[model samples]
Target: MARAKTTYVCQACGAVTPRWQGRCESCGEWNTIVEEIVDSGVGAGPKSAVAGGRPVALVPLAGETETAARVTSGIKELDRVTGGGFVMGSALLVGGDPGIGKSTLLLQAAAALAEGGRRVVYVSGEEAVAQVRLRAQRLGLGDRDVLLASETNVEIILATLQNGPAPDLVIIDSIQTLWTDRVDSAPGTVTQVRTSAQALTRFAKKSGAAVVLVGHVTKDGQIAGPRVVEHMVDAVLYFEGDASHTFRILRGVKNRYGATDEIGVFEMSTLGLREVDNPSALFLDQRDRDAAGSAVFAGMEGTRPVLCEIQALVAPSPLGTPRRAVVGWETSRLSMVLAVLETRCGVRIGANDIYLNVAGGLKINEPAADLAVAAALISSLTGSPLPADAVYFGEISLAGGVRPVVHAPLRLREAGKLGFKSAVTGRLASSDQGGDLAITEYSELAALIGQIAAGGKKQAAE
Candidate 1:
């Protein structure tokens, strides 16, 4: 008999190496390479797959199909993030940092689903049943009847799940602890995670039960397992928040059944995670409109219109390289905006030590926020407060032009609903309808800069 082969895989990037190395060449992550046997599991050759499985008949694309059934969790935010409700027989992977309320949010959702007459099973591999019970009791969910188990073996879990009728929803707390007898690799390894995820996902598809898999995030805030695990699932939702803040965001990065880039807002409280009906209002809480360098960004998350505060502070830097700090927004985007202001608009904003923040800890990804960030920076540099009742949304080009963004009418409607009086944005497209709010349209970044500086001077004169 031929001996099995072994290979080293980088836990960070899932790159296979011939031998052990101190640093991963693919990802540059140090000490992440681990040895694993490749005789079976996902790393096995094509013969392993074709040797045992029988060929099935291929079906045509034209066929009768039933609409997907949804089970609502009774949590507005959770449902919104899941595109109305959880689709039956779907598999979802939720990833977040430790102590970032991933477990808490799932516990709450399970309880809510149970209350709504859905058979929900919560299998925890990271904590005991008693620990889960304590959290449930604290969240006032002790009265609800939720099936709970503490197990890590994938075979055992699948067996237990099969014994009873297929459940409506099954949640596995932390997929890293799951191990399979088929894989020689230890738990939390790349092969084990991938194999276990494949097993659970296969069960979900065959059993007509929705499965929620919780994943652990690495130091870089990415899910620790192989990227294939994310691809296998039907949806991937990320729970993001700061420990210092009460607000947590559930953003959908990949959804086969729903829209991508959708976000649901939640607030942590003594009882449990409370759904925020009006996220814009909660995000804009305690508005200090009189302060300089504060701008309200009219943004869109999927189809939902959102408004958030963008703040910037510019100060003299003694170091030759001015320090640039950014939070809740991309650092590269900030650098681009700064360069545009300097090279194109002639704003000369590169010499100061700049700090930018998107209040409420909600990260902005769209380029529409560029104009708002620029407004905040210019306002801070000139010590001028923008209009308190105004919201801004536009994309700034490298050639100093302010480009119009999609959903302009939606952004304005949301801002007006929140009592905003005006909006400063790019020229509205013919298809983009206008709202009742006053619109301040701009064509160029330099034109906007001149207006803001002139506004500061006029305010000073008054």
Candidate 2:
């Protein structure tokens, strides 16, 4: 016979304790420790008969096979992010800031699946059933096959999945709102979230359902609950964008089924979120033939190629400290690059207050954008316009040298697609091999300026 057992667990970080404490010593969270039952004599700490869950070893290749077909979610950008489409029985957690269109995106995906004759059930803990209907109506989605349930009880949701209709795709509006009866903790508690997630994961794997959980992000921009939550799921996705901008990016941080670096771009409208197929064109500035302060950059975000605009404004500083402000870039990096420009390139930027920004509100962490930022600043200060057909990429070193960036081939291909005839970048992986692109290999900032001023011919010949 098994012994009756119970334990207390912290709702913040999944730290288990013998008794409740006023504050959690492990995570330093207050009033989070809650009492819950634990079945003793299990493989791990405790077991439960009612839980009725067990783990099985992964079968040999010959014993099991995959049956998932790549189905487009009707959003081209989204399909690109998921490495073509969602795999069967795969669980994905999507998190973002509030009003970032996380729920709307899920509903859009659900509608697409349902319209294609696939079963999709959306369980909501935040909104009412009619409210969901209204949202669907706004998105022009009136499919009856896309079922809705407004409940937060994890047990009830599982029962519905068991006895009632089984869906091909399941969506939980927000994981923090769900609660399990087995745990005394409230909804969004670490124990409840973990336990509920475990049950859903079991259901998805056993029943061959594709489950999508809409998770909430803390003030620090991390997914709420234990870090184990991300580990438990098959994939983790983050939706991000400025509140003032209509564009949003859905990026995959972890993907077991596909590439993790993939991203999807979308546009918000009165109808709903619309997928942007050609993100490069949308992110690039479209104006007259030439602009002095603006330069084009061919940047790579994972497997995707994106073109963006870098803008710069330079003016003489009035105070002792020159003001340096940058958007979508690192300020310290800007300072370093500015110093390099002043010393190596002989650009008059030391006493100037330089302001820089990427035209779109998109954040760029890739070092490949460094060349564009530097070139834009120099062009603005010197009042020289980079040719409309030229794009820049490469990392800027403190010594004023251009360093090689990753995925050079993909970056060049993307830039070529945008009809750029020439690119100023660091030396390619192989210096001798040059096919279509007229690649200018610049070892230093001074060399790049000479090439850019010579209209690319003098540098290409060198």
The top-ranked prediction according to lDDT is: 1
Name every residue pair that clashes in candidate 2: 11-190, 39-47
Judge candidate 1 against the unseen true structure and give its global Cα lDDT, from 0 to 1: 0.93
> TM-score of the candidate numbered 1?
0.97
Show pairs that collide, candidate 1.
Answer: none
Instruction: For candidate 2, give the lDDT.
Output: 0.82
Quote the positional error of residue 25 for candidate 1 in Å: 1.4
**Candidate 2 per-residue C-alpha lDDT over 3-121 given as tens digits, one digit per residue, 9 for 90 to 100:** 65667777777788888889999988898787765542111463336565688787666766766655668788778778778777878899999999999998999998888898888
Which stretches of model 1 miss by more than 4 angstroms? 47-64
Model 1 Cα RMSD, 1 decimal: 1.7
Question: Model-by-model lDDT, in order?
Answer: 0.93, 0.82
Maximum-TM-score candidate: 1
Reference-based TM-score of each model: 0.97, 0.83
